[model samples]
Target: MSNLLKILLIEDDAIEVMKLNRAITSLELKHQIIEANNGEEALEILKKKEILPDIILLDLNMPKINGIEFLGILKEDDTLKYIPTIILTTSNNQKDLLSCYKIGVAGYVLKPLKYEEYVSKIESLLSYWSINELIKV
Candidate 1:
């Protein structure tokens, strides 16, 4: 990979987390993944800012500050706003999509039911981000 990413994965589902890890390992990517159980936890990680992530993979339906709320918070912060945030979610609701886009979410992707499809989406998502010229803080 030309640009290995430090990805912040904010997801509440344990199974989803495992699946993402499995996909990365299967793809043999060298990127690092930092996981957060929910949006609240993700904020704590971001607050430290020890090293901001290259990209954020967020889930829409999470407990304690859902994706929309989290995006609103993140976009308001000058420093954090530049970090690309992509929604990896099961919700393809039009309202949800509009809200996220309005809040300036970088990307929105619906989770596929099949694992193979899921892997394909993840691969594409990572591939795009890995090559893009990202802002480094």
Candidate 2:
């Protein structure tokens, strides 16, 4: 794994975004975070091909193009499908989980309530991805 990574975070909640930023800062990992308030915005970023992300942290519910819908489009795209997409949402619905997996999501993680728990989960997730053999764009 490389020392630095580019991460695309598609989350609408401001507070959740802040929390995630804080967690990443605490870990002190060399990473660049590109944020999108919704899936549509993320798609635009992907289309630009300016900065290809090593991983994507996606939220399920949003104003436009929800996570599942976005995943469906992304997985069908030959170029973008290779990048691992992980669901980090508050929803624990069984149907949501099953649907995301069926669409080829790398992981479906429930967002923890506690700040510390959130940080721990983010840390662990990042650590795992950083160590894994990811395909280079």
Candidate 3:
């Protein structure tokens, strides 16, 4: 692998995960996608890794730990702080949007309910990251 295409997906929904995986594969990104059901699980994955991901596609709602709280903790840690986190969630609340930005999320992408829209959004995100040269594996 080129180390330029590693993505960590912190999502609780299995179906959404599958859709995302298919989208990334279709893009021919040469990427590795890692899944975490919640913030806590995601943190453990980060701890076990020597190098952080190029990007994180995070969901807001989860069972054990919510995305807002997770972002709070992630932004505080020096080692994990630099990894860019993009909120890929279903929330459209002004408060949630404001709060996420306040915590320093790189981008906020609303979840697309429709299949085609979902694929489009994911591709755009991957393209943006690739163009920016942000992937560090």
Candidate 4:
């Protein structure tokens, strides 16, 4: 059976955030998404540990602690390291992609220019994860 996902989206851009929400709403998916404007804010949210997210969608660029650096810190933690983190960024830089993989990111997806394409990608990504067995702890 497919599970309802609790998603954490760590993104700095307001438009990007809106677009993700739009996609989810238009697609009629019932997954819950929690927003964090940057890596720092995301860390704060995670530190509470009251309710851990099923998966994390991270952005490469931000004000403080970019995605790669944030990933490093998260991997060092015993509990946080297990949550699936997908790089959801506009960066198509080879180095960034390689770095994310080296640091153990679950997936790396580039944000498409077209809204329709972006929606399609989001749907597929969410669909796969919702049905996949995710580590709750």
Candidate 5:
């Protein structure tokens, strides 16, 4: 895997987007975050085949084409399925967790209420991925 990573962030909430941005910035990692408000927009981006993200940060709740639906479509595609997708959701529901894992998500992480805890999670996640080997397209 490359040292610099391109991350696709699929989230509907603006405040959550801001928090993620803040967390990434605070980490001081050499990474690029591409944002999409919903799953449909993210699919469009993926279809373009311009710049494929190494990892995806997905949210379960969205306006249209929620994360579970998106994951189904993504995992069906041979090329896209290789990208590691992690669920960064506020939902602590057991059903949601089971659904995500069953759909083959890389990780399911609950969103922490505190900024410090959130940052810590992001930092650890990024650090781990940075060292790991990723499939090259």
Candidate 6:
């Protein structure tokens, strides 16, 4: 991966976003994070960008559009399908997991309920992506 890799985070919860930002900032991972409230907003941001994100951390539940539906649309687009997407959601339902995988998500992470655990998980995810084979930077 390159030193300038960027992460797109699609999450609706304000507290969760804050926690993710704090955890990522604390790590100094040489990654820039872009935020979106929901999948629809995220799609809009993506449409305007010249370069796609190296990784996407997507939440399952949201207001405008859910993660699985978003993934369906994203994968169908030739420009977006190559970017690896990781599902990060509070829901651990087997059906959800299966659906995410079926739609070709690169990874699935169940949100840790506790703040400390959440930080840890997010940090670990960043680290994993940094060393992942699919990453370009």
Off by over 4 Å in 1: none
Error of 5 at 38 (Å): 0.3
Relative to the true structure, how large is the alpha-carbon lDDT of every model? 0.96, 0.92, 0.86, 0.96, 0.93, 0.86
Instruction: Give the per-residue lDDT digits (tens) of candidate 5, residues 20-103.
Output: 999888878778999999999999999987899999999999988999999999999989999999999999999999999999
- For candidate 3, the C-alpha RMSD (Å) to the true structure equals 2.3
Q: Which tens-of-lDDT digit does each residue in 29-115 have in candidate 3?
A: 677788888899999999887856888989998888899999999988887888899999899998999999999999999987898
List, in order, the clash count of every candidate structure. 0, 0, 0, 0, 0, 2
By TM-score, how accurate is candidate 1?
A: 0.98
Please list the Cα RMSD from the true structure of every candidate, rounded to 1 decimal place. 0.7, 1.1, 2.3, 0.6, 1.3, 2.0
Off by over 4 Å in 6: 1-4, 135-137
Model 4 C-alpha lDDT versus the unseen true structure: 0.96
Model 2 misplacement above 4 A: none
Quote the positional error of residue 35 for candidate 6 in Å.
Answer: 0.6
Error of 6 at 81 (Å): 0.6
Clashes of 4: 0
Better model by TM-score: candidate 3 vs candidate 6 = 3
- The digit string of per-residue lDDT tens for model 6 on 48-68 reads 767568899999999879999
lDDT-better candidate, 4 vs 6: 4
Return the TM-score for each candidate structure: 0.98, 0.96, 0.91, 0.98, 0.96, 0.90
Candidate 6, residue 107: lDDT: 93
* Weakest ten-residue segment in model 2 by summed lDDT: 1-10
Clash number for candidate 2: 0
